[model samples]
Target: MTAIPNETMAIIAGGGHLPQLVLEGARSMGLRVVGVGFAGETDPSLADSMDAWQWQNLGQLGKLIAFCKKQGVSRIVMAGKIHKARAVDLRPDWRAAKLLWKVKNTQDDVLLRAITGELESEGMSVVSAMDFLPHLRSPEGVLTRRGPTSEEQADIDFGWPMARQIGALDIGQCIVVRKRTTVAVEGLEGTDATILRAGELVGPGCVVIKLFKPIQDARLDLPAVGPKTIQTMIEAKASCLALEAARSLFIHLEESLTLADKAGISIVGLRS
Candidate 1:
């Protein structure tokens, strides 16, 4: 594969370790990174790692674009999580307001696609986060030491399509199932909360499935799993995790796998 040419890239960072990972990946490839971080959503320590950085409110599209232009950034990558619930309470700037008004619905895909279109219109291309850090993508097959049993495999088979349907509808990317019965479907509350809710309803031995949306834009909101995910599953007593291979991001893979193995949790990457 050809390397991404060394140039200043703008990272529109939100929350979690992903933004930091992307920055390290870019720098390792001899590219300079300028980060635009959301105030409440982004980690504060992210500023220390950037060649240049600016903090903006979730709805400050104008400021974000301006900052990228000033930094001479032509390519952009979005990383991290932006809580959909918090986005509802945004105080949009004029540009953002205009974009919001134009969209028929404020579904995750709709809103992000609009923002991406606006950025592209301004001569900035948004690239997939995986392009900069392909290693983050999970490989096909079982990752943890413990592979799923036949029963747990059945639960994954039952849950994967349902998760994908919800994802395609822009509802969510995660679902919790126990013995082929879905106990919880993720909403704006997110994966951890959904898993906890499932545990409350169905007790232990649930299979958690997270996957990329069938119609998802590769450049935005790819499904991600990490150490925190394994920790949450342990807390909820979820037995198995099924992630879409090549389409999902796995952060802290070694630590996450070690923790999963210790807990006897089975983690498999499916090629769907």
Candidate 2:
């Protein structure tokens, strides 16, 4: 594919390797990228990955906007997981505080939507996370060497609706179920912890389902799976992971698949 014109772009980074992945995408697209990474949340390695990097506190909206303007960035992308717990230390400048005041709810989606609006109003468009890495989108199929067994298929059908219900509640997107019983539900603690917890409690052979919330904005909160997800399943003794095909991102695909195969775990990109 031809690269996007090298107009400056800005990344409001969070935690995880997603920032690094996004940086790679931006550079490959021929975009000169500037990054504003969150303190205590974004990985430090991001600085070396970007064209220009600036570390900023999580709530510094005005500063972020100014930095992008200074770097001549007209398109912006926000990626990675910002620990929700860190919101307690939010130090919103007057601009951010004003935007926050306009929002009636502070759920992750609500807040992010507000931020997107605010950024757009400031003349910077928020680009989709997959703008440069379209291949990362989950494809339709049973990705692993082995497809889900009959029992796991039963669990997939069994847990699909319940898992969606959990996502609807804004609680979390991942649920580990055994025999139609939810052994673990992902919360702010995140997916790996939830899976490990389920493994310890449910023994073995649990099925893990991770989906992007039906209400989630694909441009921002797309569900993602990676090598670490495979490792979590291995540790949890889970045999299958059913993720939403096309909507989810499969990071480090070859390595993740290799790990899953070694662990005898099945990774399915469920159409649901």
Candidate 3:
């Protein structure tokens, strides 16, 4: 509910190239960013870019809150990838344990919303990375040399709403379809893995669809795709990718397009 705070903010740095990109964006806006990294998931070298930071393990919600309060950071941005499957290794402190028990299930939205509420209850604003990295939003149109073929487009049409329905159920944001048949639904392993798995199940010609979950908080966890996504589609021999345009983050657009074109893969950003 708070406006983008100009003074100080903490980024809950997860993994991948996104954390670095977000840090750079905060700098462009003249805001001080305190980086907080999750152990084993975050790249530690990223610490060098922070005004102040800490490497904390998962399930240390109390420590995360304590650090933010001590550093006087009132706004928080959750950025990058945190594998939810890593829950097996979590050692929850009192705050995190209480939160876990409070949620009816560990579905991504449920758990994340609880965590966001906890942070807000502590007087900190949970903001979106998109505010600082607006250019990353996927533009509406074909992104590669080729748009989907008629059949491929049909697959996209069939899969798009299904992906949205899956998202609405708070399941996952991605699905793979071929010839109008669902090949795979993304689980905690993530989009890339799900695409590759679809290849194993259905061979080539699969269309990958990723959407922004309908009930998702706009302030955190926007769907993202980029060069890595193109690479995965190529490896999966996927024929095309359909993203929720303007709602999804398309990272490294140029590079991703080049890769997709090279692989004869089609990438389109569709309106939801």
Candidate 4:
């Protein structure tokens, strides 16, 4: 891998393992990583991986930008998930309040785009986390020991476009289907909840489809799945998992594939 130019990169970390992965990737490429972690959302342990770290609440955009500028950071990467429902109680600073007032709605893409624009206006470019670790991107074709059966493949084919449509509308990235029938569509509750809900409604053998939003800014909010996803599928009795290849990040790929195979689940990476 080519080393990044001698510069410090600021990571705007949210939650989950992705932030740490991005930090490690940046360091491996010889870039200094300074992280600004969300108080409730980001993993507390993530601070250990950074050259310097500071904690801030979700709505402290002014502080985040100020920190980046103080550290002389020109590039920023936003990684991991932020639970949207929790934003209801966020104590927004004046800058964040101003940005919030400008947006008509709080949809994921709209809010993220506004945030990106805010950072760019301050002379900092927001970059995709995948640029640091391209290997984490899902590869095309079957990843598990078994490919999806004909019925499951049919369900995948049926659900793929619907997933894209919802994603294009910035509704969600994942949908659960059984025998070509919609079982559940993920919303604010998130992917795991959506899968478990499908299991309750359909009993078993449902397929989960996750994809990137067709109109989404790829630098922000890319779809991701990990070991916890397979665990959720096992509990939900989901039989197949399909993710958009190269656009979605698959964390712990080997371990996830092993668990899926052992549980008799099929995983496929599709170009769509």
User: Where is the poorest 10-residue window by lDDT in model 2?
Assistant: 1-10
- CA deviation > 4 Å runs, candidate 4: 1-5
Encode model 4's per-residue lDDT on 83-132: one tens digit a residue: 87887668889999999999988788998999999999999889999998
Candidate RMSDs in Å, in order, are 1.3, 1.8, 1.6, 1.3
Q: Which ten residues in a row have the lowest lDDT in candidate 3?
A: 1-10
| Cα misplacement distance, residue 236 of candidate 2 (Å) | 1.6
Model 2 global lDDT (CA atoms, 0 to 1): 0.86
| Global CA lDDT computed for model 4 | 0.92
Task: Give the clash total for candidate 2.
Answer: 0
Which one wins by lDDT: 1 or 4?
Answer: 4
lDDT for each candidate structure: 0.90, 0.86, 0.90, 0.92
Q: In candidate 1, what are the lDDT values of residues 172-268, reduced to their tens digit?
A: 9899999899899989888989998888888889999999999899999999999999999999999999999999999989999999999999999
Residues 1-272 of candidate 3 have per-residue lDDT tens digits of 23354678899998888888888888888788898998788999999989999988888999999999999998899999998799656899999999998899878888889999999999998989998888999999987889899999999989988998999998899999999999999988999999999999989999999999999998878899989988888888999999999988888999988888889999888886
Count of clashes in candidate 4:
0
On the 0 to 100 scale, the lDDT of residue 173 in model 3 is 93
The C-alpha TM-scores of every prediction are: 0.96, 0.94, 0.96, 0.97
C-alpha lDDT of candidate 3 relative to the true structure: 0.90
Worst 10 residues of 1 by lDDT: 1-10
